[model samples]
Target: MSENKTSIRKKHMEFTPMVPETTFQYADLSIKHIDAENTLAMVRRAIRMGYDAVAINIDLGDISDYYTELDMLWTPGSQNNVDGEPPKKKKKKQQRKDELADGIAGILKKKLIPPPHYVDVSQLNTSELEKRGKVFRQFSRITFTANEQVVINKVFIHPTILSYDIVAVRPGEPSVLDTLSRKTELFDIITIDHLEEERRKWLSVSKVMDRIRNDGVFYEIAYAESLMPATRKNTLFNGRVLIRSLKSKNIIFSSGAETMLDLRSPVDVMNMSLLWGVANNEARKMISGFPKNLLLQAECRGTGNGDVCSMKLSDAEKLAGNGEEEEQDGASEEKVVVGKEEEAEKVKAPPIEVRMNHSQYQALLQATKNANDMMKKIKASKAASSS
Candidate 1:
């Protein structure tokens, strides 16, 4: 009977444990020439494929080229003014009415040019999708290609780049890579274009990987491009060099998928990592653990602290209730302290324990010794003055 049951189980689909809730897949929404609909479709597909989060990558090239005030405003119909005619100024009362009627998109289109093929996730019917048991989050990542020092400088100051959740840079040469690797505050990911032959050579350097690891930056590998027959050779070559040099240290594998057909589930992506010479445990980390870490770092970089951006109403309500209870307890305690002299007298400061590691303890001892020497000098000076 046991044998029969085992056979039945084998005949059916194999049992695979559910992917952890924290596991995420970074799908490439930045595929060149991709439209808004296609990008939104990719986001939906990622959510359906069991990914908890996706980073919509945006590439900003030659920052100087995009530095005009018009670029800043990115007004859809105002890319260039005919015969240098200035934009029309509206009456204050009328302008407010138009803005209120047109809504955010209308105002945004009037002020700034949105990124090429940028999909506004806010407009998507996410509430309906969340009902299906799949909850997903979207983040923005700006990929800067370091072609020139001037360009890099322009990108650093660019308001659009700062607005992104994650900021990444693709160094044009080895010198640029070296410069960016040490500057952790300026970059989140050192992006590599798999199709570029030059990038493979640059990525192969041991020092480059070392600096990246020390500075807490991730090495990005976009796997979706490998599926294309035209770019397959170059993609594989870059992938081999990247995996060989970095191994498992601070690597994030994302499907630079442009469309729905190119997208793969997180489990499938883990299996794909095996083909790239990644170990089983490491492969799992690429899709799950590594992405989570990258997002956490990006979150901290963006908001000054890693905070969960969204919460359920139930959770919020519970937190509110707990806060009320805490407030009540605090009030009662305060009343007791004020009303009872003995209770007020009994309230004392809690003892603080200072525990230190070897290095910290040594530093503390050195500080004490320095203070003692300074005190001795002061006492000697006092004695001399009295004499």
Candidate 2:
């Protein structure tokens, strides 16, 4: 029965994404990474449409819905320690506390059978994309709709939340935008939602520009919203205001696409930017250059002291870039030593060997005794002064 289950899961995991030849440059930071066949199809469509990099977005608002359905030991107080059961080790006790703090107790408890934190794109074949110079890549991102400052604050440093490649938010008010700006290391992109016009009213000239300047965070305007008949006006208004305020500098044009139908080519998105009050030169960067900067900055966030660590693949690559790159496999070490050192320095120093007569040996011993006495006297004097 166990063997059958394993085989069944492997079969389900097996998938081949559509691999049309493509090149890199453009990025779409918001790709819905849900557990559906259509999500894979959406990624396939993205590649075919010329997107080189994409991020799988997980919305905090819909977490409960996704978690409950996945069903991996999620219950009230599941992360809490049992009253009478003693924690065998301090490490185990601390682990439980972390689980509660991060609200990932269900995932922590299961060990090997942990709940999914991000979409698995390991099965994706990118050989064709790589061959074409695109090097297709996928990243995980978490979206938070900032309604309650307290709620967003509590989860801001959550291990699972910070683990994503990007952390984006859609602020509902001016105060929330102010709060989001200060958290440079936690949040990456500030998404604009035209569907909720009231939520976007707080977006001001000074406020938007200040957040962009101070935090160096990017503002994402979804082109998909512009295509909708009802949302087109608000989308154009919000995007143009953002473009005009930032002077076409910090804006990123994305599809915010849920399905393949919503995804558009990079050229189409860039063309739309020109109509939104940006120059043709800056228009091209709205899709490619600005987003590439955002991705690099977001990636480096995990490589710095607050959240950066060498454990992540992308983080490891950044860490490697800072210093010397690794030598090729089977390279000669002798060549490296010769290249880096003088001929005299190449040979190791010989071990010291000394010979002394009886009288000389006695004098050396007496000198050593005098030096030990001098050190002891100095230490005693320093101790006396400290007292």
Candidate 3:
């Protein structure tokens, strides 16, 4: 029976790559000629090359125009003429508090561009970037830390935060000891792109694999070009290099897709994995297991089922039998349904006569009031500090 189940699972198992909604509409290859077309092509090709998932970049650079437009649209009424022109009155000295409030309000309303998913703003000294991070946090499901560069005189220091997942060094060079000393926190997954070949060189793909095995850093490597046929040869080389050097159990492949055209349908990613010499069972795990594990670590939802360890596929006939049993139980329960009015009346019924003493009730009320007062004070303090 076990052997038959394994055979059945092998026959039915299909790999599916999950693409984000924003990039779903632009998955076609023909749209590659549009502005920033190469990014899409690279992603598609990467998918064809067996990358199971893609990361979309939402950097400040890409959304600069949108930010500019929003800023113009959301400009303060006091700062503009009634006719939508700049204030023509003689300049008056503005209070620091008012100016700060206006600036913060403009940014909070999406007046500025949004940053990309992987780019962390913590390193930047700009107050605007800090504000942007806070605002974006509300809508963002993934938590990201910035990669800061520290420079003293002419020498460079390694980034402070270094872990298998979130390393301080770029892709090419070893991080300097001085910089590593300032280390703070670690991320579960650190993204490495081709642009920083220097830091990437410090740790080879094999080294990254070892870290993934020994430490639990989930590394995401991004290739610059469209990950399809044109880049297939090089991608395969890199893929083989990483796969052959590392123990197979530790590696996860993904497409670093940033734009609309960069997305690959889940079906395509599954097929591509098969072509990349990933075993059938392992390929399914790569497309499903890796992303799911990463999402859970990041405290995100709706990515995968959040099960990275294993999957069990059952026969449809067995499922049908189970469904029939459930249907019969449901049918019997449904025969005694209550209307909304009846439900409301049942809920309105008085509780059994169990009463607390006056002293106990008074104590409970006092405790609740105290808790509320404490909460209010804390909130007020936070508001005052932010202001």
Best by lDDT: 2
Q: What lDDT does candidate 2 reach at residue 344?
A: 22
Candidate 1: list runs displaced more than 4 Å.
1-33, 61-64, 68-134, 302-387
Whole-model Cα lDDT of every candidate shown, in order:
0.59, 0.63, 0.37
lDDT of 3 by residue, 192-255 (tens): 3342323334345454346444545454433324265666665555555455555445455544
Best by TM-score: 2
Model 2: which ten-residue window has the lowest total lDDT? 344-353
Per-residue C-alpha lDDT of model 1 across residues 58-79, encoded as one tens digit per residue: 6655333444233333223323
Pairs clashing within candidate 2: 302-308, 303-308, 304-308
lDDT of 2 by residue, 201-277 (tens): 66674665566556778888888877888888989898887776776768888887877878888888777776687
User: In lDDT terms, how accurate is model 3?
Assistant: 0.37
- State, as a TM-score between 0 and 1, how close model 2 is to the true structure: 0.59
